[model samples]
Target chain A: MRHILRETWSGLKRNRAMAFAVMVTMWVSLSLFGVSVLVAEQVDVMKGRWYDKIEISVFLCTKVHGGATDLSANTCEPGQETTPAQRELIQTRLEANPDVQEVLYESKGERFADFQEAYKNSPIKDTFTAEDMQDSFRIKLKDPEQYEGVMNEAVTLPGVQAVQDLHQVLDPLFAALNALVWGARGLAALLIFAAAVQIANTIKLSAFTRRKELGIMRLVGASNSYITLPFVLESLAAAVGAIICSGLTVAALVKFVVIDRAKPFIDTLAWIGWDAAWVAILWIAVTGVALGVIPPLLSTRRYLNV
Target chain B: MITFDDVTAVYPGQPQPALHRVNAEIEKGEFVFLIGSSGSGKSTFMRLIRHEQRPTSGKVYVAGKVLSNLRQWKVPEFRRQIGTVFQDFRLLPGKTVFENVAFAMQVLGKRTSEIKEAVPEVLELVGLTGLEGRRPDEMSGGEQQRVAIARAIINRPKILLADEPTGNLDPATSVGIMRLLDRINRRGATVVMATHDANVVDQMRRRVIELVQGELVRDQQRGVYGAE
Candidate 1:
């Protein structure tokens, strides 16, 4: 064991430059891989948090400028406003629908209050009153993905002026975040492949240089594993180095970018925690070690021929 | 002990077999010379004994184990009983003489204490007592060959195969190397050497196996190098 380790250490020392190249390549590629994992987790967290809150807002007929506006303009006559009976009927239909998980009534005053709170910093915040706001039904669906059926029905209702599925507002945001995740993952995959090839090349070169020693070892009756172990260990050492580097890099990214910078400013959305960071590091470590060990193991068998 | 039974060996991408239907046997502790011109399958015969090259047909038995039947994984274990010395004195260039000799035992996973004890004794036997710190390039051709011999014998292998151990040395130095190999043979390791050194072979007057174009032309006991 000591002999093997000494051989491995000497092999690394002899080819330190090539070994460093392999480590750096693995570090960069694995960092990207780790970041992609974290990003994927972030996308999932965002999807969960925001998707849970998504609801269909059905704006009912409202009296504006002494004429019915919104859904009333399409469903009701020009001067027709939503009657109390029509509002009650719409509420009962939404509540009875199997896809509708819950229906909450928001009166004009409540809508106006929400608008005021949302746009408090605007100059026209005080200009809007209860009469200017539309009464609405916020419908939470049993399955948010089933919104299209509820939305189409809500739009044609007697009182509803507009049916807005919140998913439409959130889908593109999620799509962009998902694209970022896949893009990073794809690039990381490419870099990891390149790192594997580089490791193979390094192993090939190292084997070529030390072929005389290998021949001597073989002639001296060393087993195949005995002859191949040092090369494998050299690559594994580089991989371990890369894993630690990538792990720290990913942790720093999570700490500085996600936690320190983004979390403080964007506290409304949950960011990835250290648990997710650890998961990503675990992925990087596994990938890094595999990348480090496999290439050399395969190439040495070919090049050493022992 | 080594035995070759109707062995024929053809290397890849070659038209002619390197060795063809060669039959010979050497008992334990015999110093045998394999004399032939280039391409006479002398090296191939040695390789067969070491299981480096398997016979294309028939069998090669080294210490009662069939060369052709030896599994790929077991070849190393089989080769442990046979030591090999090449013409180039295949030593690690960067390692010192002591390291070169100890490396053989090291590869076999010998304990450090055993290696420490055996390496110096073998070095002293090879007449390289105090040159332990010198690398191969720092030594003369004869000294380098001695180091190679020391490495080959350090494990106390039952069979020592030397393919032109003194091929690069002058006649005087070659005589010295022959004497060392004779001493080793006297110590009960079967030594098979392939060489074109007529002077050494004629002086030693040991068993000689001669090959001609992969055919066994002669196997003479106490034979001279024969009329060239």
Candidate 2:
């Protein structure tokens, strides 16, 4: 072990420039990967936090009688009054559904009031007065999974117009985030592959430079395994150095940037536990060992000749 | 302790064998010179003993082991028992003279305690004690050759093969290298030096083997370096 260390140290010193280059390559690639994965994780946390409190908006329609051009729209359609009795009956039916955790009834006037507050200064505000809006039920479900069942039942009601699931509203954002994660992973893979090739080339040149020395060593009773141990250790040292640089960079990023800024959202998601830190460490450590070892095994093939 | 029994070596993409029908024997402590003109098989025969190239036919044995049957894993061990010094002085430019010599012991995984003691001792044996810290480029042609010699014998190998060890040096430097080989041989290691330097070859008056083309033309005891 000591001999291997000595040999590895000498090799690293002899090719200090190459060692630094590999270090920087590893640092940059892993750093980029670290930040990207953390960002995706944070976005997921935010999604989870927002999903729990969000409600589904289900719109209902009134009967069309004498078409008064829908004037006094705040009032029910002409001869199509939805009396208190009719409203109570709809409420009773919704409350009886198994998936319905809670149902809140909001009249068109209330929706219009909420809209007025939501879009206070928009020009479209003038076009959409409360009277032009539909009366709706704001529904909550026992489980997020039951949303589709509840939505399907609500939309088929006699006066219902639409049942909007809030999760669907966030689907596009989640999909975009998923795509970003995959894209980052792909780019990281390409860069790591290039780094491996670079490492192999570096080892090849190292072998070429020491061919005669290797020949002499072989002659002087050094076993093939003994001679190979040094080169393998050297390659691994460079790779491990790169890995350490990358791992530290990743851990630091997670600590200083990701956790610090996303704490509010992260705290809201209970399942996204602190075990993520351990996983990151293990992943980076494994990546480092892999980067260090694989190239040496391959490059040793060519160097074994001389 | 080396013998060649009709050994022949044929290189790829060549019209003729590099070494053909060669037979010779050297005792354990013999000092022999392999002399020939350019394109002769002097270097090829040296390579055969070192197991750098196997004989294409017949048998080649070193220290009682049939080299032809030795596995690849055993080649390094075989080589370690024999020392080879090239004409080019292939000292690693980055290492100091001491480190270069110590590298031989290091690769053998010798203890650091052993290396520290052995390196300086060998450097001193080659008349390079105080110059241990200098890189190869910092030394003269003669000095670098001496360091190469020091490296060769660092492990106290059984045989030492020097192929044109002084090819790049002046006559004075070449003579100095010859004396070093002589000193090593006196320490009980067999020495096989391949050279074109007739002066050094004739002056040594040791056993001389001559090669012409791919054949052994002469093998003489107490020989002179001439065509007689």
10 residues in a row with least lDDT, candidate 1 chain A:
A65-74
Model 2, docking class: acceptable
Give the Cα error of residue A198 in candidate 1, in Å. 2.1
| Tens-digit lDDT track of model 2 for A1-306 | 587677678888999898788767766665565555555565666666666677877666555432233221232344464556646766777788898788999988998888888888888778865557767788777765567777666655544555677787777877887888788778877787887888778888887777876666666767767767777777677667766776677676666655675555556553333455556556666776787778867886755543
**CA lDDT scores, all candidates in order:** 0.88, 0.78
In DockQ terms, which candidate is top? 1
Task: State candidate 1's DockQ.
Answer: 0.56
- Best model per lDDT: 1
* Predicted structure 2: lDDT: 0.78
- lDDT tens readout by residue for model 2, B21-59: 999999999999898898899888988888877789989
Query: Which portions of model 2 miss their true places by more than 4 Å?
Result: A1-17, A35-178, A205-245, A252-258, A263-273, B57-59, B92-99, B116-144, B169-176, B220-223
Error of 2 at A284 (Å): 1.0
Record all residue pairs in model 1 with backbone atoms less than 3 Å apart, i.e. clashing.
A71-A161
Candidate 1, residues B1-228: lDDT per residue as tens digits? Answer: 789999999989999999999999999989999999999999889878877767899898889887777888898888789888889998899899999999998888899999999998998899999999999999999999999999998888999999998899999999999999999999999999999999899998889999999999999988999754
Model 1, B191: alpha-carbon shift in Å? 2.0
